[model samples]
Target: MPTMKLGYLKVCVWLACVAIASVILYTVVMLSRRPLSLQTSRTAVFTGGHLRLWQPMDLHGIPLWDLLMLYMTQLDNPILKNATAQFNLTLPGTCGENFHAASQGLKNISSYPSHFQAFVLSMHFRDYSLLVGPADDEACPDGTQLLVAVKSQLVNFDRRQAIRETWGQKGLVRGVTVQTLFLLGKQGPGDGYPDLQALLQLERQKKRDLLLWDFQDTFYNRSLKDILFLRWLQGHCPSVEFVFLGDDDVFLRVDALVAYTGSLDAATQRGLFTGHVFQDTAPVHDSQHKYYVPESFYQGTYPPYVGGGGVLCSRAVATQLYKASCHLPLFPFNNIYLGICLRELGLVPQNHPGFRTFSAEAEGQEDLCAYKELILMDHRTPQDIIRLWRGLHDPALAC
Candidate 1:
């Protein structure tokens, strides 16, 4: 009887072990398909109706419950996994809509200087060390200046020393003090140098404010949607002159662009969404093509927004556009969507004569040339940008 009991007990133990193993394996499988986890908070906060989602309808009329359920159901279903790891999305909206979104509630215009000119310099700062060798040859011209706001992820604390030593010294160069709006955002707040305030406060003034961006946010893929915080400029701070909207690597002919646009209608100077334009077919979601618009996010066609690289829109126009975009839904691609919105609102993107959207790859070719010839912008490497900036004004090296 004792032996029979022992045999039955062993069988039961074996079965129990198998059941536990199966449960473990099942959990592992479920975890592997975590596209929309319970911790999904990738949403746009409607802080005063700034459109963050690039859709035709506003957060107003769209069946809120249905959309929520759809999103939640997708999150719970572990079998269906569709997640994108990118931080930029091209939403469907015209330029006019984008302008309106930026221009709403622009209060107390009289408080700011009536001649309140703006230079929207779009900058991207991936590397600060790159700024070392590129000396100031084509400096900020007379009557106009630049404000450099940089977003970088370089982890070294010592890097700020170099940045401080270079930019902090107010006496480095004379005649034109380049007003720097330097903002360096990394993976974390503590990631950058703690003593960076010296460089942060060039000419005894700190320009850049708090900027923390999480790359994992689903809505993070859309750049235009993310920049909705720009609405803070309205009615709060109005002493802004010439806001530049370009990336870090972009070598800008600031002197020339300023000289030329300074003479034009300062209130209306904008970009041409400069690139190859295809009319009427509408933007589709072809991953292979340059003009692909994703199907899941954007349903219909896209209006023209300027190429994201280098766009220049004045504060007045920006405010006007923002006002117009108040009731509209979010547009994904800021450049193209802004273009489409502007077209609808009876505004046009004027092409710059010096702008070059593409570059020809060849041996011994300089990437950018912003000399007296006045090249507006160029997409080049840090090394190339340094070289181009240095060589372009050399007087001898004429391209």
Candidate 2:
């Protein structure tokens, strides 16, 4: 009986050894299959030889499940790929010969006196006659206290209407004169609506707030829109004290912004270009991104730039930027192009606590006050804009 018991014990020990060995082999295989490059963050936790990782969030603050989705989708989604490829094909060659050889696309062939002149001349110099200008130019005049220029699409009539009702209403805000204008470019033939131009004309007659240009309104041509607006401003509305440049999708607290600007002394306001600024950001190398910059185009780090969702700049800075734009090549990214202009002018963008580019994810009712305090908030739909405007202005609601 003692011998049998000892033999059973031996068998149990052998089984335990085998089980431990199997676990070790399984762990090794799992580790070998795991992707090393996927660990973008250093905060990964390793447990039982398996890595648990965190991913960066999207613009909406949702966790990105796949890091390569942006790249993969470019290839997988045919419509998106075709659109992006068409834009890429239109991009002019970089300053280097290698890029010209590699891309074999549009080449810069102007033989100007200097590089600056070459850059300025290389841009498509088509003069797009304006379809509409400020209707009551004599009312606001050149000395308008604040001029708000909104970048808008041709079909965003609802958003433009929301603006007219809310903060964009042209009138006295806090004893300051505020004028708003919607800026747009011509719709391309592929936009599928032949009557868009006629509709725009009708809207212009009714509103008299549209500043339509004749350039093709593509996502990549946003910089052209900005520079052209600058040129127009220099000629048409030169004496405005401050200009609020923003997108139509943003919600602007015009009253708050006007009060803030009015509080500053005249000298302090002249040289200011303040917003939510990005510093030490590098150009994206991933070809899948809309804002990607190949090494042949720009190899250096991007200069600090204010978020284009909204920015408040003095007339002085705008003038300087316009001059700089004349010399700098047209960059695909409008905000980054503005950064390049600022770099050329030796001006740095100031960060304002009130300018927020991120969505306000409120924690409670009290958090609504935070939205009231911000100068601008991005990613707001037309409905969201109207709702927020009403909520903030509600007399009974208190923080």
Candidate 3:
């Protein structure tokens, strides 16, 4: 009887050993499948496994997921392969100092921008819910050819009004339907903003053109706003023929815009993303500058990106861009971030002379004739926008 008991104990020990080995094997295979540490391909080449930063294992954050998706894309597309290969070089401080700590469940990342820190925290806790927006398909009624999304703020009521009274008027334009929406983010008293909530609510009720989200409406959070808007577009206006994204302060020649877009060939229209293109630009390191980028934040030159002040993209491109954005981290500069996503998708931005983001030569001094040919121009005040719109549309005036 004692010998039988000993044999049973030996069998149990063997079975336990097998279970332990199986668990170990499974873990190793999973880890090897995707890189656990979110190191760049360049860093991986140099360290050869020495600097293992603690990237989140769940692949929930945009940065980590983007790295994985880029890696997968590199395997299939040679363009991504070359781009990834060229991206091989470790510059200091791309990831913040507390990256490892944050990965290990600590939230002491004060060195980064407040918006960036908020984005990081949002990875674990934030739904990015829509606070106010179009409630039904009527927002994009039948034959909607162009949807204009203008980024605006609570304090910019005058700009929104100017746009509405001018180029942003809804309904038909040049035989095609055009719709408009003003994108806004929440601002509260805690943020030093006035109590404009009631006024904004009334504005929404009267105009029915505001799309508000539950995020801070700060300069740095512009990228977040873009992402949220893209998500909303995918859900709401996915079938729209084209999209024009710009700021509320810009003057857009709606008639000229319709004419230009209508003239595009089918193929060009399918992938259209036209504006003032910035090519081979480097990130700014000046801390005092509004466009400052820390050396540790990003290391490469900017990809060809259309200016954010005004960009026009086709329905197909808009859809693809939304998909690409899912696999990329948000850059502090909203336009630059879109450029990075374009690089990931191997799409190049098209430069058009009509979209003059940085106003044309002597823009303030230019007569109506100079402005007549322009499609979009930035840095215009409410008065300027109104004056330009009226002057350009005058029936008695000939350019």
Candidate 4:
């Protein structure tokens, strides 16, 4: 009976050990499968000697846990697993098949004769009936010194107002003719903001500064906006001396910008495309990053291109770019795609320190004097832009 009792006790002990081991294994797996939170350091993944590739759309959308699992299973790299755990890095792979499929579609599109022309023509063309343009064609008649095309969202009335009241005001800047227009795309039913269309029309009636296209307004469709803008320019305002392509959020120093452009010789102005040029950058592979690019879409290195926040191109250069864009495949990154257009044109973007796309200084440490000198400063809120515009011209506050 004592022997029987001993045997039973051993069996119980063995079962308990198995249960404990199983619990430990389950706990580890559960932890591994958990997604990394937003609080995880982004810089650690990108900058800490760990190069990560990300898809632009998935970078912020996908969780790090899923990315790590994919890398562990596909790559079987224990080092990558450790790095993903340690730095919480997300890699690209989940949407690879989808991206490949889209790439194939693009390839099929390119297989046709005059594919680029056909693609451009397929974009629904809207006429001046819905446009709120210059009151008179003579207002921007031939020899207009500058035409500032501000890419704006349909719902951002405050931003458009601030721009109009501030640097985007129509008139002479430093004795040069400068006119501003807001570029917009149609807001579709899928956008879930049907009321915004009515408000947009009201704003258009009041401002008469809007340039609308029929394409769906979306972040991914910015390239379409750009192309449409080019086409509009070609059709309507081809004679403008120079074009300033900028975002609505950017603050432009109209006086300073005009002075700088006026100083450039006519020949130099014709071929000029200058801004904060990015060089030696690669497409991000992380699927969660907003700026991510898939290998299937782009396999080559990006050409040197200016930051899209603002770019100043001469009329001739703009025309050349528009022509070049027709032959190239549509790329999602508008600015980088512009670089490709410039590349095709055998031109290079000139980097200017005065175009501060990545902020002029560290946050909370902005130098007003430096800001005053820059032609373009990006990422400012509407109120901040107004304040900056006011301060730049404030006689009492000399920087």
RMSD of each candidate relative to the true structure: 23.1, 21.2, 10.7, 21.3
Candidate closest to the true structure, highest lDDT: 3
Clashes of each: 59, 0, 2, 15
Candidate 3 on 1-399: residue-level lDDT in tens? Answer: 999999999999999999988866654433333332333434342255542223322332323333433344333332233444332322112211122112433223456576556554443222477888866576787778899999999889999999999889999899989999999998979889888978998998998888998877888777777777877887776458889988888998888888998898999999898898989788787867778665544555677888838899888888888777654545667788787777767789999999885544454465888777789888888888888778777898786
Evaluate all candidate structures by whole-model CA lDDT and list the values in order: 0.39, 0.67, 0.70, 0.66
Which residue pairs in candidate 2 have backbone atoms (N, alpha carbon, C) closer than 3 angstroms, thus clashing?
A: none
Q: What stretches of model 1 exceed 4 Å from their correct place?
A: 1-178, 182-226, 235-237, 266-281, 287-292, 360-364, 367-374
C-alpha positional error of residue 288 in candidate 1 after TM-score superposition, expressed in Å: 6.4
Number of the top-ranking candidate, with TM-score as the measure = 3
Which parts of model 2 have CA positions greater than 4 angstroms off?
Answer: 1-126, 135-139, 360-366
340-395, model 2: which lDDT tens digit per residue? Answer: 78976778998898988664555333356778778888877788788887888889
Candidate 3 to native Cα RMSD, angstroms: 10.7
CA shift at 134, candidate 4, in angstroms? 5.2
Instruction: Compose the digit string of candidate 4's lDDT tens values, residues 1-399.
Output: 999999999999999999988866654443333222212434223344533433121333333222333333333333333434332323333221122111122322343334232432332222212344545474365556899999998778889899989888887777788888888877756867555767876876777778886656766567767877886677676558888998988888878878888899878988989999999887786656777654433343578989948899998888888776554445667898788778767799999889986544444455667787788888888887877777777788666
Model 3: residues with Cα > 4 Å off, grouped in runs: 1-110, 113-126, 358-365
Query: Once model 2 is optimally superposed onto the true structure by TM-score, how far is the C-alpha of residue 223 displaced, in angstroms?
Result: 0.8
Model 1: lDDT of residue 77:
35
lDDT of 4 at 188: 52
